[model samples]
Target: MSMTSILLTILGIAIFVVGLLFSIAWHELGHLSTAKLFGIRVPQYMVGFGPTIWSRKKGDTEYGIKAIPAGGYIRMIGMFPPGADGRVEARSTSPWRSMIEDARSAAFEELEEGDEKRLFYTRKPWKRVIVMFAGPFMNLILAVAIFLGVAMTFGFQTQTTDVAGVQKCVISQSEKRETCKESDPVSPAQAAGLKVGDKIVAFNGQKIDEWSVLSDRIRDTIGPATITVQRDGQEKTLHAVLKKNAVLKKDSDGEVIPGKYVSAGYLGFAAQTEIVPLSFGDSVVRMGDMIENGVDSIIALPSKIPALWDAAFSDGERAADSPVGVVGAARIGGEVMNLDVPAQNQVAMMLFVLATFNLSLFLFNMLPLLPLDGGHIAGALWEALRRNVARIFKRPDPGPFDVAKLMPVAYVVAGVFICFTLLVLVADVVNPVKIS
Candidate 1:
């Protein structure tokens, strides 16, 4: 790499790190602000983890930045309910019981004269749920805002009806080559005199305004068909008998899968594409697709671990869609910056990367597992359900749920996360994904 390229890479990584810190701060801000609003005492609001880089005490809350840029948190008082005896439970011989008590003790360690009423667990279940939900909600809001901003301003890359290239002859997709041989049969489009730059307006009397629509119709039509094209300010219809030929198969997402071919009706022209601005409705549809794909990707994560492990430790090729960690994302950010594109396009791509990260955070943290924001929200909701049931049955209220009792489970979850993070880091260093 050249000196300029290396320097640009460093700058991009730095920019991404800064954006990450800001996102963490934004997430914690949601927790901190909501806790304060609900009369809960927030003793600390820290972005990142490990040793503090800078801190300032204001009112009762100590705000600070930490060394690590991975994650952040807000220390809300009484996050867990007391034991059967109180926050101070009787000593238990079972290791699991001990783990539960230790968690409860830590929650109330900073007890002060007026802190009793300001405890988080003292709040109503609904309020507690809101507090826990706020952090992920903030990330969701940021993701949506960023997506909408980019979609409305920069637009999307889309294929148009204009023909970009015309094939000289039919080449089977199984051949895996774009070059045409002299012995190959003439393509239907070439035989019909379809030329480059012709804007397709209709197919078999059906109006065609979109390339996808035209592509589908062509794929389904086997025999003779009329193709209407708007060329040189005039509309003209061309006739040809479409041939059944082998073509590369595309996934549900319209992306061609490599080395996968199927026999289909063939057209012999490539559609041109441009970055076109989309309407609000179109943007919403785009977001919906992105979100659906994102969810599917997350759900399929466990299945990809073996591939990820092989890529990190062996000569296995790393799949392009493998899960990425902080290090991997930072490297991708650098790659994006070094892309040979317009400055504004680079900025738009960076924003999109950040937005996608935020969206992932929102989705991941909403899982009903301990230590994540979603876990706490689930606890509060369960508590609400129990109390409501009691009210209906004329039984004594169950009071606040003892979230601390799940400390052991949370610890296990955190350990797994840390191990996964380390594995990802190693993979990122050894066999990182490249955009090119």
Candidate 2:
């Protein structure tokens, strides 16, 4: 890498880290604000984990920053109630019972006489649910806003039916050759007298507007076809017999995967791309598509672990769709900044990346697992259900469901997450994904 490239890479990583910190702060702000709104005592609101680097006491809350920049949390007092008798000082012989009692004791360790009313567990189940849901909801809102802003205001790169370049000769995708050989045949587009800057008006009696539609049609049709073009404000027609040729297939991102090829009708032309601003409705639809894709990617993550392991340790090529860690994403951001596109395009791409990251955060945290926001929400819902069931049967109140009882399960979940994160980190460091 050149010095300029190295500097851009560092700058990109710095910007991404800053954005991550802001996102963590934003997520924690939701929890803190909601807890305060519900009269719950929040002792400390810290961004990131580990030892505190900076802190300030304001009223009942001590806000601070931590040394680790991975994630953050807020400490809410009375997250779990004491035993059924409302007494924290208790002991049990059974290991599981001991675990439950220990968790209950620590929850109210700082309990005061007047703090009973301000306890989180003392609130209504719905209020507790809201408090837990608020953090992920904030991230969702941020993702939506960033996506809409980038799609509607900054626009996206779109391919048009206009021709940018016409290949001179046919080249097989498997050959991996850029230059044409002596025996290579002239491309159908070149033989048909197609020129750069020609706007394809129609293809095989069908009106052509979008490049994707036209390209698909051209790829599917291998016989003779009439291509109508508008060149220099004058309409013209060209006849060419499309040839069945080996062509590289591209993914949704328009990147060609190695070892993948499809025999399609060759047009031998590249489409011109432009930054096209989408309408509000279009932007919303596109955002929905992006969200769906993100969900799919998350669902498919576990299935990619084997491939990730292979890439990290063995001599295996990293798939383009491999899961990327923060380091990989930062490297991608750096590469995007150095792309030859306009500055606005780079900014928009970076924003899209951050937006997707936020979206991932929202989804990941919403999993109905322990230590996540969704886990607390699930606990609150379960508590609500239990109380309602008890009331229906005219039985005694079950009281707050002690989520702290699940501490052991939460530890397991955290361990799994740490292992997965380390795997991704090793893959990123060893065989990182590239934009090119």
Candidate 3:
């Protein structure tokens, strides 16, 4: 690769890493801030996952970095399995006393009884839930901020759905001209009996304003179809058969809404539109709408996971599009950067994709399961309810989340996550998603 190409490639990967870290840190910070606000003890605030790279005690919390770049988290005392054995001195101790200080010294403290310091359970259940949910909410806010910042800096382009022009191959000429004037009579469009300046009236009887509509219709139709067009003030029917293009990587949107893929087609055409900038208010609203749509789509994606996963893994023509890892993201990013459009515009498109990626992270973590934010939320909620019901029955309050009972589930979840990551890595290695 050329120096500039190498630079862009490195730059893309670097930006992606930085972006993921920034996004993840901001998410964890939200949880930390809320927990502190509610007077809950957060013993550790770490960025990244896995083993700690660096750590130090800072007042009530230990701040550190972990080896895993996937995400970051805050460890609050009471938030884990609710029934930790540490009890407040039943005899009488000031609520103002630090729970961490006491837990450090108390040898008899049980894991299920709540710890006074840094324990998440001592705080109100509602507060605990808020802390867990805040991470995803923070992510949504970050996306909005990034989108708005980009929009404000460069007026958002107003892309039209209209076909202003078309791309057709032609021989280079010596004379300047306003439009294509072909001397050759046997070009593809000409051989297909298509003429320059021909206005496309319809494809498969569907009205075509933009090339995208025609492209999509043609892909769906697949075979020779009657294409009606107005050329030289005459309506002509061209028997056109759409050719199949390579199946590229599938997009996440396809998992939510059926039939979301946009395959390549050699229609021998290109088009451009008048760029328009969105108003600041409109841009903000549009960004919000994007988030809303993202949430709804994520909620609906589970039903299609079986089909989507099948497509992703099956060793068939469609499997060619299944990308497995960070390499795939880089390959795709490089291709996007090399689009015929402006580089800044390409970056903007990448940012939009990143926004969707962030949105997926938010929604996926919100599902109630072990290890994810949603899982913690579910665990906390269940603990709170159990405690409340026990209080109503005039019985002893149950302990925090039972680690012994949950260990099996945790192992299962961890195994699945690892397997999926490995599968994706393999797929990325073997069938890396690259753009042409």
**Which has the greatest TM-score?**
1
lDDT of each: 0.89, 0.88, 0.62
Best by lDDT: 1
Give the distance in Å from residue 165's predicted Cα in candidate 2 to where it truly belongs. 2.5
Clashes of each: 1, 0, 32
- Give the worst 10-residue stretch by lDDT in candidate 2: 250-259
Q: What TM-score does each of the candidates earn?
A: 0.95, 0.89, 0.62
Q: Candidate 2, residues 94-127: lDDT per residue as tens digits?
A: 7767766776676676666788788989999999
Task: Enumerate residue pairs that collide in model 2.
Answer: none
lDDT of 3 by residue, 1-436 (tens): 7888777767776677677777788888999999888877677788898899899997778888888777787776544332235443233264323333343333223333344554565566677789889999888777776677667666554423333544344332222232555652222334455555566777777777755466566546644666677766787877665444432323433222233334443343433445455678978777877777767765654453443355456753323323334556655666576567787777776786566557667877887876678876887788789989999998897756442235446557878777766666655555555654
CA RMSD of each candidate after superposition: 1.8, 2.9, 10.1
What number of backbone clashes does candidate 3 have, counting pairs of residues 3 or more apart or in separate chains?
A: 32
**TM-score of candidate 2 against the unseen true structure:** 0.89
Which sections of candidate 3 miss by over 4 Å? Answer: 50-57, 81-115, 151-162, 165-275, 279-327, 334-341, 384-404
lDDT of 1 at 135: 93
Off by over 4 Å in 2: 1-4, 92-99, 168-186, 245-264, 390-396
Q: Is candidate 1 or candidate 2 better by lDDT?
A: 1
